[model samples]
Target: MIGFHFSNYDPRQSGKSKFDQLLDLFTQLLTYTSGDVTEALQWLNELDKKYELTDDEYGMGDFIDELKEKGYITDDEQRGEIKITPKTEQSIRKRSLEEIFGKLKKTKTGDHQTYKPGLGDEVSPDTRPFQFGDMLEQIDFTESIRNAQINHGLDSFTMQEDDLQIRETDFKSQTSTVLMIDISHSMILYGEDRITPAKKVAMALSELITTKYPKDTLDIVVFGNDAWPVEIKDLPYLQVGPYHTNTVAGLELAMDILRRRKNPNKQIFMITDGKPTCLKIGKRYYKNSFGLDRKVTSR
Candidate 1:
């Protein structure tokens, strides 16, 4: 929703303007700033001056004004600080989708495949010979008749497997997906920024499911000692806490959420770099971090 000149949209292109580079830098800045608009702007300003990112005509102040004017962010009345608006959250999700999964072709339905045929509104160009289980409507009568005539000529005619061509189609089925992100302290430990990329990827996958597969339901959960679901808007600010990895808790919560969905197609995606170091047993936390804990992994 941040209104910038559409001409500067493609930063990867050969000739990017000053605004394009600034925008790209700003998006990355949000990851470290944790959705603090004011702090992010400050960092952007500093970098702008050092790198000469902006021109005299298009300055950092101009970009800040554009962000506020476009309703991408707003002031938190209670906190009296600049925070990202819903529009900004949506834009972040979209940008993440492009950066991560831009190479994927947009399908009309879910990404998975189904054996059922003669379904879905959009018909595919491919066709196959009619099988016993094929629906009557799936049979291409015109194509079948044409084939019969060509094979038997005008003298003889017979309906056979070679003559029957069944049109193939894609079936749209609702799906329920649970995405679990590991947010234990190790995610940010060793002086690395792993959580940010993970957040970006999670946001991208969430957006992909919401927009490309409207019939699908996506739930995101982060696990440290305990696991809890997170809203899409809260993804950008997700950070690792001083907590141990609780893989079991994350899986339990994800399974619980997926159990309520009506969709038959259900899946779980987990992104993590370390082994489980903690397990919850009836409210008590069992922690271990020295080496691979077989007990935690077994769970």
Candidate 2:
């Protein structure tokens, strides 16, 4: 058998400037703080103090000034806090998408389905003879000209409706999606840090849907001992709580949210690492962590 070869990547093996390193550190800290600029900055300072990452000439204060100049954050006198800009939030979402899914596939061969060629409302690959009731815009001018040339000699070329070609197409409308994430205490069991990856996936899905499918609407919700909706920007700050998995509550909330959406094309995605262990019954919460609770799982 041939030996396998693998290469290791050193992130710090670069010619990045001090400012670049500071920006990278800030971006990393943003995830833990949920795009909160002040919190991220404080964490960055603490990290810098611990690791001596910053030099005397280029310190954290200078980095903050650079961040303001770079349009990443802005100070609000009204709120008495610096907030991350929309551009920074978008950048965070994109980074999360890249971290989880890599880059978007450029071809038609992947888990993500690219548009297929069909005779529907949009453009289709297979074309047929021009039929009645087809719009003039649908006619393939180049193909029609070629057909005319084949039917009549170039010396006396003539075109007719019979020589026209129409394109086949398919139509798709808006879609509504509900993304459910599990934030139970088990997500970080034994310091595995499962919630961070789940949060990245949520951000990735939201960014992908909102960008690729502009007409589509996406709602994200997290479930633990309870379930509630969270904004896309809040994904970076998602953390596991001292609670058990409540898959039933998550599913119920997803269905309830989808039911209110006007779009007929609606779906739900549940990301979890364990089975249901808790659910709310009227005013009381039922908890079961010993093993797989059949009643909770059944729902």
Candidate 3:
């Protein structure tokens, strides 16, 4: 695991403080453990001894105590375990999402499709004359007020158009999304755990689309020896397998999944590192660990 370090801090502007140094150190530790904070701290202890770091000035122990004190990390008393705070998780997620998705484009309209206010322009084929059951917005307000004034007396300022209001219609947009995740052996090979970040992104995106875009459909497929649909909750525990990359399988599965979706708008988001290494022949899996096979590439 590579340790990450953030060195962009401006001591002049933010002050050359211990907290900043600790943040830098914590980031460095994250690179090593991919934010497996407890494991990183344990490594930090070993590193402190190997480097002979000053205990009073730059001690990992002190830094962790400070981290817990400041709520960046917390202790689960019952579990006897230290865990990252919700704040840290959210910050890491925001940073990770921004890094991968880039910035969300700013636009005049809302990100998602929204219906126009008031009773939609689409009216029933039969337009009945303004009646007691008709919506007020459907009723021409001016004409209604005029009718009320005429029917009542001059003192009948209490106008009655039956307080008609528009009956709002609903419009639905069809959206289909294919979320691709790489499950190549490199994800966890040589002790680097890139899979964690990938899994987190998958989980977050799944949660986001499911909760906020009820009208839209999101399909998650993992590509390794073969691509298949996996539930969102399964993501957090997803692990890299010995199987090599079969990107074609992933794409094929994604396309197959999208084909089932009748939505007019379809999009695919693939997350992968390195090239393809395996392909399938009928029901048999063709293994290739050295290089990309042109046959698979063409597929």
**Best candidate per lDDT, number?**
1
* RMSD value for candidate 3: 8.6
Question: Residue 5 of model 1: what lDDT?
Answer: 58
lDDT digits (tens) for residues 100-179 of candidate 3? 55576765533354364324444323333345654545655555566567777568566654533334433445578999
Q: Give candidate 2's error at residue 98 in angstroms.
A: 2.8
- Strongest candidate by TM-score: 1
Instruction: Assess each prediction's global lDDT (C-alpha) against the native.
Output: 0.83, 0.82, 0.68
| Per-residue lDDT value at 40 in model 2 | 84
**Which regions of candidate 3 fall more than 4 Å away from where they truly are?**
1-8, 15-35, 42-91, 98-105, 114-176, 186-219, 228-242, 252-266, 289-294
lDDT-superior candidate, 1 or 2: 1
Models 1 onward score TM values of 0.81, 0.80, 0.53
- For candidate 2, write residues 1-299 as lDDT tens digits: 79998787543567888888777778767877666788888888888888777876878889889889989989999989998887787878887777777855675432223365333455667667898888777788888899999998699999998899887665555689999999899998997878767777788889988887777889998999999999887787788899999888898999999999998888999989977899788999999999988878777
Cα lDDT of model 1 by residue, 82-185, tens digit:
88888778878888888888887866654555656547765777888888888888888888999999988868778788799988887767789999999999
- True-structure lDDT of candidate 3: 0.68
Question: What order do candidates take by TM-score, descending?
Answer: 1, 2, 3
Displacement of residue 274 (Cα, Å) in model 2 is 1.1
